[model samples]
Target: MNLFLILFGKIFVFLSSFLNLGSGSTWPGHIALSINKNFLKDTLTKRKFKIILVAGTNGKTTTGKLIKEILETNNNKVFHNEAGANLINGVASSIIKNSTFFGNLNFQYAIYEVDENTLPTLLKFFSSDFIICLNLFRDQLDRYGEVNIILDKWRKAFGKLKAKTTLVLNSDDPQIASLGKKSKAKVLYFGVDEMRKTELEHASDSTYCPNCGSKLLYKRVAFSHLGDWMCESCDNKRPIPNLEKLVSYPLPGLYNRYNTNAAVLVSKSLGINQYFITRVLKKFKPAFGRQEKIYINGKTLQIFLSKNPVSFNQSLMTVKGLKGKNILIALNNKIPDGRDVSWIWDVDFERFIDSFKNIFVSGDRTYDMAVRLKYSFKNSHQKLSVFENYKEALKFGLKKINRKEVLYVLPTYSAMLDLRKILTGKSIL
Candidate 1:
């Protein structure tokens, strides 16, 4: 019965792609779950696999990809939700497609990037040999309410891991480091030794300590509120760095530094050799749509997925670091890209006025975003154009840049998906 259901879901995936029903991000699992809601949990129980569960506000997908790569580099068979699918249904879709008809696995290891809210429920079903918490910020505020609420859920669900379950943490994030204090399981922390505060976005929810609830004093903020955080009233402080920037990472910004550090330490803790990790870091490209670059006609187009305030600010910082280039920003308020469009106000879009040569905007909320930018611009001469239609915006944005000149695209989740499908003539799904 389970085999038949799994096969059915696999068929749905193929047909969905063939007939263009949007590549089965939801339906295959919906159909499979209708047959067995326990399909994912049930399948995993049959195999005593080594599991790695990664959950956080950002960098979950990239970090999971790195871990999968490192494991495969060492010749380990692994399964993961690599399509940027982190929820229960998404994870189930991956499992159904990857598993044999009998719900058996060919992989020795499973690397999963579970959603922040999904972590609690998934933890009730299966356990992990290692779990990595990248960081926590208030995202989908309508959905999750507060950072502490998600943190409490994580602390509770993750607290139940077996004695051997290794919790890999970001020592720089107080919200992340606090997860280690009460754990009976082995905990490994990784962070940068020091980085000067580049651009501070006060929109971060990490201004207070998770331990004592007192204000956090950041001696240096790497990006957003992630930094060398210290609490005046409590014993909670940023963990001493176990791993720092080893090499000039392939990805941009201080955020990628944290991502690489977490991946390096997690891989090392799993007994993966330093040599393999070094090579992985050297060769790793940005996960697609995450600073993913496309070149055509001597013009480079970069995609930076900006979903939340901190990431949006960091994306701008990424643009600011590059030589002034034409930029296209697309925003949408789909369910996947949080319904609340209010976070746009949180990003310091004003900072980009001096950074880019030309700015083009598109997506569902282009007008709203244009209004936001109008209030944000500091320079009177900055060229800002708005397009409600992405095709025109893509054309206009692409045409503005010439040979060796880059075009940076900053997009919300849905906008990124839609534009990628159109740009590459391939579904980002």
Candidate 2:
């Protein structure tokens, strides 16, 4: 029955791709799971290859790709589900796609970037050799609720982990670091070493103690709630990270630093050499739509997928650091992007809104974003423009920049896929 499901899934995936319907990353697995509840467990129960599950609200895709790059560079075979397919169905589909007709995953490593809500459930199907919980933030509030809700779920999941499993956690994130308290698994932590007095963003989550209800104080903040935090009430504090600073990082932004740290720690835990990991990272190009660069018509465009407030703020900070002049922000309130567009207001646009020379807004909620920008701009808003047509906006934004200048595009989840399809003439997951 499992073999039949795998064969059936492969055909569906092929037709989906052949017909340009979609990536077929989830539906096939959905059908398979519906047909047989234990399809994932049955297929993966005795697999020889190691399994690594990466879970968090942000950085899942990039971190998964980072781990895959490091492992594959060391000559270890690695496969991961297409980006945005972090759900159970997607995991099953990846298995089906990678498996033989008789159901075999012929790879040394399978890195699965799991959805925040899906991790607990995914663990029920199979026990991972390594589980990396990046950081928890308030994201897709309608879908995942608050950070504490996820923390509760994660604590339960971590409790189920065996001693053989290695759990990599972010020490800067209080909610994440606290998960290590009672877990039976071997816990390794990764964090940033830079410490200074930085104010928390207005929309920061997990500012309170996980142990006590008292507010957590920060000696310094990395961005949101993550940093050197301690609860004076309960005497709970940030864990001393097993790995903190890296000699080099592939991408910009402190968030990417955190992502890199998580990936490097996981690599080291897997017995990958530090020298090899550093070499691989220096040559690492970003995953698609994640500071991914593309050139056309003597013009350059770099995409920074900013789906939520925290991610948006970080992207803006990175673009500012790059001295990016042209900016395009595409906001889509689709199901994939979380229908609630109100999150845009939480983004600290006022900090870097005036830095860009030109700003273009488009996508399903063009005016909504335009309004946000209009309110954010402190000076004359002559640089801001809006377009209902995203492709036209891209064309105009590109025209505004020279070959040497990069048009940095910050887009929501679904908007990123649409913009990529427009630029590359094909969909990426």
Candidate 3:
């Protein structure tokens, strides 16, 4: 019975991709769920495969990629949700594709990049041996409501975890670190030291204590609100993470350092080979569009998926460190992009005006993005160009960036996908 369902779903996935309609990331699993609501629960739970679920708002995809590589380098066969599909259906699809015709799982391990909001429902079907919760922030306000709602959902969901299931979390994020309070499992944490990054963004997501509602104070901020924090009223402070020394990572930005820290902690807690983990950290490649760089015609084009404010700010910092001038930002309001384009205003773009020589804005919501930039770059002296379409924008972007300069592309979710298709003739999703 399960084999027949697998065949049916695989056919739909094939047809979807063949027609060039989409990446077929979710439709197959959606149809499979319609046929058997217990598909994921029945298939996944029946297997002896040890599963590790990576869930959070920002770093899920990148962290999941790192963990997957570590596991594979350690000689474990892993099946992962690659390009951030991340929902329940996507998880189901990843499992289904790795199964034999008789519905037996071929892999020894499954590392799923799960959506933060879907963690409760998805875990109801299957429990992970390890759960890596990176951090939470205000992202896609239309879809997530706010950070607190998901925090409550996770609190309830984590309460159901078994005693043996280890919860690996970022100690800097009070909301993420606090999920283990009710869980009977062993909780492990990872965080940067007190002197990683000091300057804090003016607009941060978590500034108050989750328990006492007192204003949170950061001793040293890594990015946004993630750092060594303490609450004066409740005496809640960032946990001293039970982790070991990690080799330096090649990935850019302080955010990537935090991500590597989280990955190292989870890998250690899982009893993975430390030698392999350290080597993988030193030799890690950019996951998907997370700081991926390409060289074209003696010049370089670096792509950073800055869909939200914190991520955009980090990308801006990365460009600043490299002393880049050619910057192109793409915006889109598609379903995956949260349909709310107002978040662009929340990002700190004014700081880059004096440093940047040329800035190009384009995407589905190009005009709206351009208007947001106009407000910031009005006083600063910088060459700004706007295009309503991506094609014209890419032409201008490629032409403006000289061989001696590096062009940095900052794009939202859908815009990143479209940009990849235009550049490499392939879709990552």
Candidate 4:
């Protein structure tokens, strides 16, 4: 029975591969195979592979990619969902497509970027050898009611894990680090120690104590609510770092420092040697739309996608450093890009008011973005143009930006995809 199931699974993957539908389609096919318990068990049971599960509200994609690179540099074959399909079906599909006729995976490790809400569900079938929890923020209020709800669910789930599993946690994030205390497994924490970059100027999340609901005090803030914090009312505080090393990447903003440090610590814990990690860190480039650069007709345009408050602030900081006179901003309220557009108010848009020649707005909620910008500046001379259509906005914005001056384009997730389709002549989704 197992042999027949394996043969059928292989045939299904072989046919699916011919369609060239890309990595995104693999999850739907994996879901079809997971329905039969014997098929899933028979295939996955034969593999002796290390599993690394990355769960967080943000930075999962970027950090997971970094971890994969570190492992691969050591000649380890890794199987991962490159398209950010992190749900149960997506993970199961990646396993099915990558496994052999006898259900053996032809990879040394499986690194997955999992959604925070689906971590407990995915753990029931797939056990992770190492789990990295970055940080939790209020995101997609329609889908994930609140940050506390996710913390509670993860607390319960980590309590049931095996004692031998290694948990890599971010100490800067109070809510994520709190989960480490609940886990019976060996916990390893990573954090930033630079006081110069710790002070945050704006209102951020994670300001209150997760334990007693009292206002938490921060010794220093890296970005938003992420910092060296301690709760006054309870004994609970940010965990002591097991690995205290500063990462200086070429990327602008302090947020990347946290991400780089987290990746380095996790790679070291997995025994990937510090020498290899240091080499990879120095040469690594930013992922698509996360400060991706492109040239069009002898003109240079930098594209940065800001989905949430923390990311928006970091991207804005990077843009502010560039000597650009022209800037394009795109906003959307799609399901994937986040429906709660109110988070825009939390972003620091005042910093770039006088830096740009003109700001062009596009996306489904372009008018809302325009109003937000209009409210940020007192004078109308800053130049704000609103376009309901993205193509028109891009053309108008690009035409105004000369070849000598750099154009900084910031868009939400869906808008980024739509912009990519227009620029690259291909739909990545």
Task: Give the number of the best model, judged by lDDT.
Answer: 2
RMSD of each: 1.9, 1.2, 1.8, 2.6
RMSD of 2: 1.2
lDDT of 3 by residue, 229-266 (tens): 89999888888887523557768777777778878787
Once superposed on the true structure, which residue ranges of model 1 sit more than 4 Å away at CA?
A: 18-25, 198-200, 379-382
The TM-score that candidate 4 achieves is 0.91
Each prediction's Cα lDDT score? 0.82, 0.90, 0.82, 0.77
Please give, for residues 1-429, the per-residue lDDT of candidate 2 as tens digits.
Answer: 999999999999899989989879999999999999999789888989999999988899889998998898899998888888889999998988898887788999999999999999988998999999998877888987777888899899889889999999999998899897898999999999875547787868889898887999998998888899999998999989988897778898889989999999989888998878988888998989999998989899999999999999999989999999899999999998999999999999999998889999999999999899999989778999899998899989998888889999999989999999899998777
Q: Which regions of candidate 4 deviate over 4 angstroms?
A: 1-30, 37-46, 195-203
TM-score of each: 0.95, 0.97, 0.95, 0.91
Candidate achieving higher TM-score, 2 or 3: 2
Q: What tens-digit string does per-residue lDDT give for candidate 4 at 1-429?
A: 555544665576666566755444354435455566544344554568888888887788778878888888888999986555777666666766676766667799888888889898766665678898988876776788888888889898899889868888889888888786767888989887754555665647677787888988888777777888898888778888876566466466566666777788888887888788877877887777777887877777788888887787777777777666777888999888878799888878886677777888889999888888998886774598889998898888878888887778889888998888887787665
Worst 10 residues of 3 by lDDT: 243-252
As for lDDT, the candidate ahead, 1 or 4, is 1
Q: Cα deviation in Å at residue 244, candidate 4?
A: 4.3
Q: What lDDT is obtained when candidate 2 is compared to the true structure?
A: 0.90
- Among these predicted structures, which one has the highest TM-score? 2
As a whole number from 0 to 100, the lDDT of residue 236 in candidate 1 is: 70
Each candidate's number of clashing pairs is 0, 0, 0, 3
